[model samples]
Each structure stands twice: as C-alpha cells, then as structure tokens.
Target: MKPTLVTQTALFIFSLLLYCAACPAQTAQPAPNQTAQKVYVGAYVMNLYEINPDAHSFYADFYLWFRWKGDIDPTGIEIVNRIEDWGANDEPFSDSVTVLKDGYNYNGLRMEGRFFHPFEMERFPLDRHVLDIQIENADYPLDSLVYLPDTANLIRMKPTLRLPGWDIEGCSLTAKTHMYATDFGNTDLGQEPYSNIVLEIPIARPVTYFLLKLMLPLIIVLLSSIGALVIFPSRSYVDARISLPIGGLLTAVFLQQSYSDALPDVGYMVLMDKVYLLAYAVIGAVVMEIILSANYLKRNKDTNLHALRRIEWYMALFLILGFLAGNLLLVFL
Candidate 1:
C-alpha cells in the first residue's frame, strides 16, 4: 500500500511540474472598475503650420504629449478627431500620421507620446474649432499622488499661449471646458494652451487699438472742423475763435465713448492716440485764435461790422480752400 501511495504522489508531482513549465503563474489584474485617462497639453512656436485659402488643406504640425504615472506607456492616449474628409483611407492628401520614433516599440509602456497630423484644421474659413484628445490606461495602473501636476512626471512643454502676434482678445481666452472621470481622480484639470492653433490670419494686428483707433478719425474730423470755423466766421462772428474747437470737443467726447466700448481701459499710446493728440492741439489752436482776435478787435469797440465782416470772408475763403488742397495731397501722397 505504501509503495502504491508513493507512486501516485510522484505522478501528481510530475503533472504539477509540467503545468508550471507550460503555463507560468499569472500576475493579478486590477478590478474591472475602469478609470478615465489623464493627459497634459502644451504648445511650441515654430514659423511652420499654414492653412490654404480653402481651409480644407492644412500644413499644420505640433507635438502633443500624453503623460501619466504607475507604468503607463504612450499607447494610453489618443488624439480623437474625426477624419471625415480624409476618410481614414490612405489617400495622397488623406491626412498623414507620423511619429518621432520609428522601429522602436514600447512593449506596452511609453510615457513619451506624440500624435502628429491627425486631422486637418477645418473646411470653413469663418468657423471656430478645436481638437479633442482622449486618454486611457494601456498598461499598469496609477493612483493619485501629492506633488506639482501630481503623479504625471511630465517635466513640461515650452512657450505658453499667444504665439507670435497672437494676442488673445480680452485675455479672457473665450474657451469652455468640461471634465469627466474626476470622481475616480484625474488631478490634471484644464490647463493653458491645452487647446492651440496658429489662428491662420493673414494679418495679425490688434483687433482693437485701445490707444489710437478713435484718435485717428478724431484728428481728421477736428482738422476739418477747424477749417469750417475759418469758413463760417461771417455767420457767427462773435465767438469765432472758441466756436469750432468747443464743438469739436463735444464731438470728440462722444467719439471717445465709442472707442471705450471697442478697447480695453488701459493707459498706453498707439497710432490712434498720437493722431488724436494732434486733433486736441488743433482744437486748442482754434480756442487760442478766438481769444487773440477778441483782444485785438476790442472788448468794447463798436462791432466793426464792415471791417470785421471783410476780414472774416477773406480769411475763411483762403483757409478753407488751402485746407482742401492740402488734404488732397495728404490723402494721395
């Protein structure tokens, strides 16, 4: 009986050894509870990336990184934009994708991730847009940690918003964000330059010139109005000097209000500001002219109707005609 028992034990042990050799012991997997992925976003400057007139063709390129902790590889993140026009098939212009690393596979782990040329900008010129990126865990698992950008080990990316002449309006950014899966913990919330585009504008001047916009037009109008005072002196001769600029001052006040709505409230000079300063000086000249004329013509000298009238007519005639001639040169030359 002992001999028989020993033989059976030996057979069982041999079978066990074979099983171990054939199928190694499996490492455990976490519970089926899925977690939403986390990702970091950044933008860099290069004089590259242009969109054609039709907006359908784009020559845009930028590197996006997907970073995470607890044994995560690049396969964890995906740049999820629809390839409708390109149609997912490999056509000549059908949206190309390339990676920095070729012939190197991460074997299910790569924190250094990049997605290039995933899709074109947009088909419409005037339409606003964005690209949505989704991230997930492909290998290993990471829980929360206590540090900057926490647990992501992202080191960082370069040159935050407003690329080259791309000053954002209001600096308010005009972007909206919605977060999901935070309940399970993705500490990397919405961040700067998370969304980026070259803005594709042929001219990137300031949308609203706070300093010089109204000032330019104001100078033009004020100059013209001063010439008008020189022209209309016979009609209202009592306050010839102060009349034009005072009226201009009121008009300028209204113009300034209009400018306030268009530009931010700030103290700085621009082309517009310089032009308006010229206008102010012109208006002040009109005021000074009136004061000097009043003193010379006399506070109590019987209103020299004929002599004053003659002076007004010729001065206005010469001044107005000269201004018009000069304006033509200014406009053309």
Candidate 2:
C-alpha cells in the first residue's frame, strides 16, 4: 500500500509538471490597444500643377512630413488632423464637400496643426494648395484592425509643412492671416476626421493688398474717368481734345481687363484705383482747359495770340503753383 501511494504521488507530480509545460508562456500580454502613439503634423509648400480660375479655386499637392513617437511600430495607421465638418452644430453647406473614410478628395490646400506656411505664388498661379493630414487611428494588437490579414491601415499622418529653408522658391506667407493649427493628433476618435483643431489660412496680406489696394480699385477709378479728356482738352477743332483722354481711358481699360481672369470677384479698392483716379483727374483738367480756351478765344478774338503773350506767363504760373500745392499736400500729408 505504501509503494502504491508513493507511485501515485510521483505520477501526480509528473502530471502537474506536464500541464505546466503545455501552458502558454508568461512572456507578456500586450496592453489593451497598447498605448496611444504620438506624431508631428505639418504642411509644405508645393508647385501647383493644375488650376481652376473661375471658382477662385485651383489644385496643388501638399507634402506632409512627420515623425513617429511611440513604443510600437507606427505602421498600417493613418492620421487625419484637419477636418472640415459641416455637420458641426448642424450648419449646412454645399453638397459637394468631400470626406474620405480612408482617402482624401477635394480642392484647396487643407491640413492640420500649427506653423503657418504660405506658398510662393507665380510659381503655381492656378493650383489650389492643400496641406491637411489624414491618419488612420487603429490600435496596435493581434486582434486589432491592424492585425487583420491582407488588410492595410495606413498610419494617419498630417502633411509636413515646414518653414522655408531659402525663400520657398516662389511663395511667402503673411504672418497675420496665415493658416495654422495646434496639437499633433486628434484626441477624439468617434468623429470622422476627428480633430478639435480648426486651421484657417487667413486672407493673405500681400494678396489682399495687391488685389484690393492695387488692382481692382484702380480699374474702377479708370472707368469713372472715361470720356473726360475728349470733351475737356482739345488743341484742334478736329476731335483732338476728345481723343487723348478717350485713348488713355481705353488703354487703362485694356490694362485692367488683362488681369480680370486671375482675380476673385470681391468689392474693394487697390493701388490701381489710386492710379485711375489720378488719370481721371488729369482728364478732367484737360476738359476744363479746353472750355476755358474756347471762352478765352471768343472774348479775345485771337486765343493763340493771347496764349503766347503776357497772359501765357500768368497762366503758366497759376498752373505750376496749383500742381505744386496739390502734390505737396498729397505727399507730405
């Protein structure tokens, strides 16, 4: 009985050892969804390849640069940082706003994260530049979406928008209205393209000043000055007074038209407006001189004779003084 008991005890010990050996290794259980990953997000200036001028819209590719900061390999996951959500607050917008479940399709330079960067225009005049990033927020695990055989979850990465190394070829960003976003990743996963950050490219200062302060306003002023010189200033009876102002106004009109296709339709004045206003003023002066001359001729029988005589000096002095005073006030003030 003792021998049998010893043998049974030995057998039980052996069975326990075998069971332990067959048990799974206590190496390490991967944490639930592992720890969240961190990464840098930004945008880059691009050379526009195509453009659509009518909509004030164009197409340009945004190069995004980023670096991963996590314990696990940052693969098969995507990062979407800049999200334009019309559904927010139930605000309605166009029916064409494009949203990507795993890809992006739309116009304009869109991206997420801070570091305001602007592209050099003249390099790509027609393409809309977009730099927003889209990341796949998948967890790291065997049973997670990443481990699914034959499936790919590209790491969601915000586009890398770096500051210019040496004057980004042909672009510059205005510091005030330049677009940028803060935070590296979307903390919210429930929202599609989830990101609490809203990035906005403010109206470019140079572009705004150029179009409004220089171009469009000038066109308007030039148009208003039309038909002035032809009626105001004429040296000959054969349509000379009417012709120069007409020609000048026409020339200004043509110049204004040349750039009409490139500008957006907005209401504002520009440097061009100042120029046209000046041109109109000159045309008005021309008309006044013509009328004065005609009246002078009728009063004095020989207008040319009066012009060349003592009256000429007085008229010259008055005009010189008037112009000097006007220009001086404008310049000094």
Candidate 3:
C-alpha cells in the first residue's frame, strides 16, 4: 500500500511541473499613465510688413519665448505657417537654455520670415483678414507635452507698428491641440496630436481705399455713360450719343481689370464686380435707347424734338437713381 501511494504522488508532481513550463509566467507589464508636461509660450510682434495679397504671403518680425518645467526640451519648434527661405531668417537670441529664478527653464528668439495665408478676396478692397503666426513643438506630441499661452502678456505688438493701406484692429492668442490625419508611418505611435500656439492680428483695409480709390472711379465711369442720354436726338448728334457710351463702356472695363489684376483669380464675382456689372447693364440700356430713338425718328417724318428730349431726361433720371440704390444695397446689405 505504501509503494502504491508514493508512485501516485510522483505522477502528480510531474504533471504540475509540465503545466508550469507550458504556461510560462508573464514578465511584460502595462505601462503606467503619465501626465503631459506643460510649456508656456509668448510672443511680441515688432513689425508686420510687405503684406502682399497677390503672393498670398506676408512678412513678420517678432520675439518668441517659452517657459517650461522639468528636463523635457520644448524649444525644438517649427513655424507651421512659415514659408521656407534659405538663409533669410534670423538666428535664435539665446545660445543655451535660460534657468529662471522660479525654477523654470526658459528660451527666447527673434524670428523674421515670410508666412503663408490664403487671403479671402470676396470683399477685395473692403476685405478684413486676421494674420496668424502658428508655432508647434516638432519633437513632442500632445500626449507627452502641451502648450499654454502665457496669458499675462500673450501677444504684444510695437506701439508704432503700422501697415500701409491696412488698419490694425486688435490681436489675440490661443493654444490648442492640432491633429494630423496620418500616423506618419508609425503604427505604434498612431495619429498623435501636437500642441500649437497661434498669435493672430486682425487687420482691415482703410475705408478711404474702398471709397475713394475703388468706388469713386466706378462712379465717374457710370456718370459719363449716363451723360450720353443728355445729347439732343438729332441725326448730327447720333454719333456723339453712341460714341460717348462706347467710350464709357471701354473705360469701365479697363477700370475693372485694373483692380482685378491686384487680386487672385476666384470662382465667384466680388462686390466690386457686381457693382461693375450694374454699370455695364445701365450703359448697354443707354446704347439701346439711342438706337431705338434714332429708329423712331427715321420711321416718323415729324417726331417732336422737345418731347423726345423730355423722355431722354426721364430715362437718365431713372437709370441714375436705380444705379445709386443698387450700389447702396450691395455695399450695405
């Protein structure tokens, strides 16, 4: 009975050993959750110049700084909206990291470069735009690091900063996580969001440019075309009436082209274009009126010159008032 019991115990121990070897103990463990580090960013715009709508770019010079805690380096930054210009940009203001009295690491630099912005030209001379400067840490993902706007003095511009033909309305600063669509071929990392800081300057064209430079010339062309109706309805004055409107039409086309040249090609017409279209229609109506009147006089041997003059005056008044009213609606509403 004792020998049989020993044999059974040996078999049980052997089975237990086989089970342990087949299962194997797990050595890999899941990583613990880590809190993302925060980096404070600030900027002071010194100058904004060379704003060119045709090129869809503008030049800016600004001072940029960063404040962060711990050993993580957040100074490896990239200007997301900057256009690459070989050797034209300024170097960093600091050669090494700055240790502040409050136990934070700081670094700063003066940046000068051209930035890209897709200008909305629907309003053209009356358009308003917000020029922005976007900064991102090229090395750190939002999971590991995030940005905080130095709200105390987030965005400051030079007191004397001026952009010709543009009025600076105000400025704003913000920080947010910007996500890229692709994983950048890193399946392990997946699609990571990056912390970004944006400094925006709202600007608008001066009202004088719209009123005097653009609208005034258009008004002149319109008045000149309307003047064609003032000429007397006689065989001798028919050439004058026809030629005046034709000249005004040519001038209007040239004026539209001049402003259109300053803007990029867009799919739809702008407010100015709409105004010019009204002018064209009015001029065309004048041409037709002159032709019809000339035809009527030829068909009837005795057409009253005084009665025809009265009709022409009424037509001119109607067209002028209609044009003015249409312009007001287009501009205001």
Candidate 4:
C-alpha cells in the first residue's frame, strides 16, 4: 500500500507547516528591559513657615510619598537640597512600608526641615522664587530606579498655607535624572545618575508690601530733600536749605542700610540698591543747587533771585519726575 504522488505531496506540505510552527517555540526571544524600576513620587506640603533670603533657605513641613510595584523599595529617599540640622527634622514613618489593595507598595514620611535655595534678589521685594524640595534615593542609581511624578495628583498644598511676607503662587512636581560628577568613594562603579523628584513651590512678595512699606518711605525721603529747593534763596534761608538736603541724605542712607541688612551680601547690586543710588544722587544735586544759590546771594545780594527760584522749581520737578520714571522702568521693564 504505497502512497500516490498527490498524497505524498500533501503529506510533505503538512509536515513543513508543523515544523514552521514548532521553530518559533524552540527559538529564544530577546530579553525584556528590566534594568530600571518605575516609581511614582508625590508630595503634600502642609506649611511653609520661614523664608530667609539672607540664609538662602526656607523651612517647610510636608509629607513625601512613593508608590511602586514589584520588590524594589524606593522608600529610602534623601532630601538632596536639605540643610543639615541635628534633631530638627521630624520623620515619623521613616521605617514603615504599606502594601495597598492593588498590590502596589506605598511609603510616606513627614519632613520638617530647612531646604536650601539660592534666591535671586535682583528684584528684591518684586522678586518671585521657586522653592523646591528635591528628593533622591541614595541607595539606587538611575539605572536601577527611576522616579515618575504622580501626574494625577503630583503636588498638593494645604488650603490655608501661607508665608509671612510672601504669597504662594502655585506648585508643581518634576522628575529628572541627576548625574553626579564623582562616584563618592566607589572607584569601581564610576559616576552614576540618580533618579530625582522635585516638588516646587512658587512664591512672590505682595505688591502692597512694595508700595506701602518700601517705596512709600523712599518717596517721602526724596520729597523731603526736594523741599529744600522750595525755600527762599536768601542769606537767612541758606542754613536751612543746605541742612535739609543733608538730613535727607542721612535718612536715605539709613533706609537703604535697613533693607540691605535683610539680604545676603552679594557682589552685584539689587533693584532696591539701584533705586537708593538714584535717591542719593538726587539729594546730592539738591545740595549743590543750594550751595550755588547761597554763593550767588553772598556775592551778588540776590541779584538774579527770580531766575534762581525758577531754576529751583525746574530742578524739583525734574528730579521728582525722573525718579518716578526710573522706578517704573526698573520694575516693569
């Protein structure tokens, strides 16, 4: 009972199909990428109590948390931007982990510590700053663990959170790979990138503070200096006019020093410093005008007193307008 040619051909075709199906099962597939573990990180800021521009730091109370699956534990996190203070930080859940109903592991801790941020004071009272709480896993490199911001609810701040001199603008969260230049003491591993999560809080001073507290006093001092020009250009008024500008000069210096003490000593001048410089210049100019007028009165006996009075008026108007315009340009532009 030998098979026919057509039957033999059909048998060979079936055998080839079977072999093709079995080849895929026997051959090995490429391995999946299992180098990094994905971690979702978030923060709920309860309060921001102290912000010191001179110290370049701010005190914050917040809850930091992490969520992830599998066996990787990313709870051992460190605040990279935190200022070290012995026995100051309060972390109650520093050693606990919870397994959620969906099998994802969770861990959180309350942090009360000072965080460092180099504040940009070019604008001073008008300055806006982003205070950040940067976190990183000290034990895990970026290759082993990567942070993902919980975009659904990344940043949550308390409804009534407030800072004394600042207004809370908004908040945000971001994840990044922070690469270190040195590998600490590990010469074999070289430098490795670390997963970093930052919770940022944007804050700015209220415009009312700038207007009422800072600029209003400065304007008063400037006007007082200009008032010296309005006095009579006579011999009796010489002492009064000359002394008025001098007094204003002293007050302006005192005002500037008072604010400067609140800020760090930086090489460059801030906006408020520039404004004070203008004030000083205006006061000096007033003194010069008064001196010239007095010399004319002594030598010529109020010969061109009318012209001198007119010049003084013009000078006063010019200084006032110039100061206002300069301030506007410095602030808005």
TM-score of each: 0.33, 0.38, 0.82, 0.82
For model 4, the superposed segments whose C-alpha errors exceed 4 Å read 1-35, 88-97, 101-103
For candidate 3, lDDT tens digit of each residue in 241-300? 899889999999999999888888788898889989999999999999999998998898
Ten residues in a row with the worst lDDT in model 1?
Answer: 169-178
Residue pairs with colliding backbones in model 4 are none
Q: Give the clash count for model 2.
A: 59
Preferred candidate (TM-score higher): 1 or 4: 4
In terms of lDDT, which candidate is strongest? Answer: 3
lDDT of 2 by residue, 1-333 (tens): 999999999999999999999998874333323433433333343333222323433233334322343344433333333223331111112234343453332222232222223333332112234332233333432223221111131322223422321112233211111112333365553222121111122122334444464446544544343333223222444256445546656766666666554554545543343444555565566556556765665666544553333453454345445544653453344
Give per-residue lDDT, candidate 4, residue 139.
91
Model 1 deviation from native, Cα RMSD in Å? 24.1
Where model 3 places Cα greater than 4 Å from the true spot, the runs are 1-34, 88-90
- Candidate 3 local lDDT, residue 47: 90
Model 4, span 169-212: residue lDDT tens: 98888887677878789999987778888989999999998899
Alpha carbon lDDT of each predicted model: 0.39, 0.38, 0.86, 0.85
